[model samples]
Target chain A: MARATGCLAVSLGTALQICLLFGTASLLSVGGGNSVVPEIQLRAVDTYHWLSAAQFGDLFAIAQAAPGPSMLLVTLVGYKAGGVVGALLATVAMILPAGVIVHVVARFWQSSSGARWHVAMERGLAPVAIGLVAASGAIIARTTEHSPAQLALTAAATLVLCATKLNPLFLVAAAGIAGWLGLV
Target chain B: MSRDRPSSDVSLGRLAATFCQIALASFGGGLSAWSRKVVVEDRGWMTDEEFLSAMTLCRVLPGANQVNLAIYVGSKLRGPRGAVAAVLGLIAVPVLIVLVLGYLYFRNGSVPATQSILRGITAVAVAMTFAMAYKTGAKALRSLPAWVLCAASFLLSAVFRVPLPVMLAIVAPVALWWAWPARPDASP
Candidate 1:
């Protein structure tokens, strides 16, 4: 077992780090959680060496499957780094600052019809966010599309989703079956 | 655009419950679809147009779109307190579940069935994202110039591998100009 430090110190330090990660990711998340995956990959796999690339990918997949935001990978990383205490610390840290900020902003927005500059800001942001989303898709495709079979699966899934009104779960199930069969 | 009177009919409790439902039911990144259903279709919390506008606003905000969305929806329904309640409920429940699951997974090195299920979900998520992009783009890309901006940004990011922030800095201003041009009457 890893050495057990004072609970308060571990909690506080882990919480602080989690807050910083969540805050920076939130502020810079123009395109959403998917857009921030590369940054998370860099920090978790490359910088800290907490997990290998494959492990990180697996964590991401699990995060997506579970629920809530895709950013929940933070919790898994924290767990790996420090255990249950770390997971709690990270979860609280990741949420608190952004929650406060949004609450404050919501209050201000409620009372005031936002100024023209605020409207202008949204207009300016929309395309940037869209571009970021596109970039995120490209990055995920690059990283995950390692084989011809995987590429075909991705392409077929994309086409099915685009062309038909079929629920997306069907595509996912088919791909999983293929993966299970070692087809991709 | 119209500054209508705020509706007093929507209850805070109902809104909070709806947000919790969204959070819990939103397995496999289902918040976007669940949001469309609850807010726009089921609850009539907001009109379809209002829901779309809120989605856009949430996307640009500095948080998970779902969390940001809870804030927007709650605030719209009641006030700041409602926003706080909604967001807290949405996050706390999910966090608890995820933490417990994480603990279990840590103890056990792998869960094969879970892994397989996620592989399936990932394939679907990718497709869903693409479809969402197309739908959103089609609605927002009203002009030829707007399409040009979308195409250019896509190519620059997808093909050239330009960093996203830099690409946005280059394309966003142009898109703004195209979408809401300066009116002759308003200009000095």
Candidate 2:
């Protein structure tokens, strides 16, 4: 772990920047991790030139395939910007603010467990959150799927996932094999 | 079945270890399901009702849902230090794994050999995002108003490229109004 981060010389300025970017993103990432993905892509890929859009997509794949949260994409983006230090900083910043908020609210949540507005808020926000989730998918699709074969594969995978209870890792693994074989 | 508060005697090591197991078990998505299984079923740290409510609260808050959940569970059982320990446990190994993968990726600089495989995997990952939307939308978009809200949000972010704050500013009020309980004290 130390050697991996040691590969790059991390600077204070870069550390600060990574912290600022991901910390703000953590709070704004209402709905879930995917909600902030487009913004992170915009900053990390377009503004900062830390990585290519394709690389961002690739990292997203790796994060998804890996264990833990898909939000680990933020770590990859940080790594591109500042190496291992950037990765750790980004992950911490991404979770800290939101983590604090949840910690504080969790206290209030216990007390307000059955409040009427609470139920209303829950029902009311569900559709909106679902929409944001779909938008994230659309954004990712735009970034990742270019070739006809890739696009078709994405569509097919989506269909399979929606129609069946089959685990997604199988789809990802099969797709990787297909790619390795140059089938897609 | 026990609706009373759980004992706070759980050690920090146990909290961390449980979450570590949950994180490792949650590869390829389904972190939430894994968390419920472990926290509510296996460990009995929280009852079904408490876990379900905490799940909703975690989602409703701003952080990554799973991370926020870890915080909630940790704090509930062991206060702030427990929260830190649980989160570290949840992410420690995974962070190392991701960093190693990332190092290999950057070092190779997109070799043609692995490019094809990554391309294939990227497609499935993208599909997973859409599948999540569909699964959630199926339950949430049963009514016309819900569909309208869902579509509006999709268009705003996906097509118009609106920032999140602005998008929520436009749609959230209307959604809350539509969803507010008709009776102030009616049974759910």
Best TM-score among the predictions, by candidate number: 1
Candidate 1: share of reference interface contacts reproduced: 0.38
* Candidate 2 stretches greater than 4 Å from native: A1-94, B1-66, B69-82, B102-114, B185-188
DockQ, model 2, C-alpha based: 0.49
lDDT of 1 by residue, B1-188 (tens): 22223545556666667777876655544466557555754566665434544665665556677777788777766777777777766766666766666656655756446554445445455555565565455455655665676678778878887765576577767755654525422311
CA-based DockQ, model 1: 0.34
Per-model TM against the reference? 0.69, 0.68
Candidate 1 is scored at a TM of: 0.69
Question: What's the lDDT for candidate 1?
Answer: 0.61
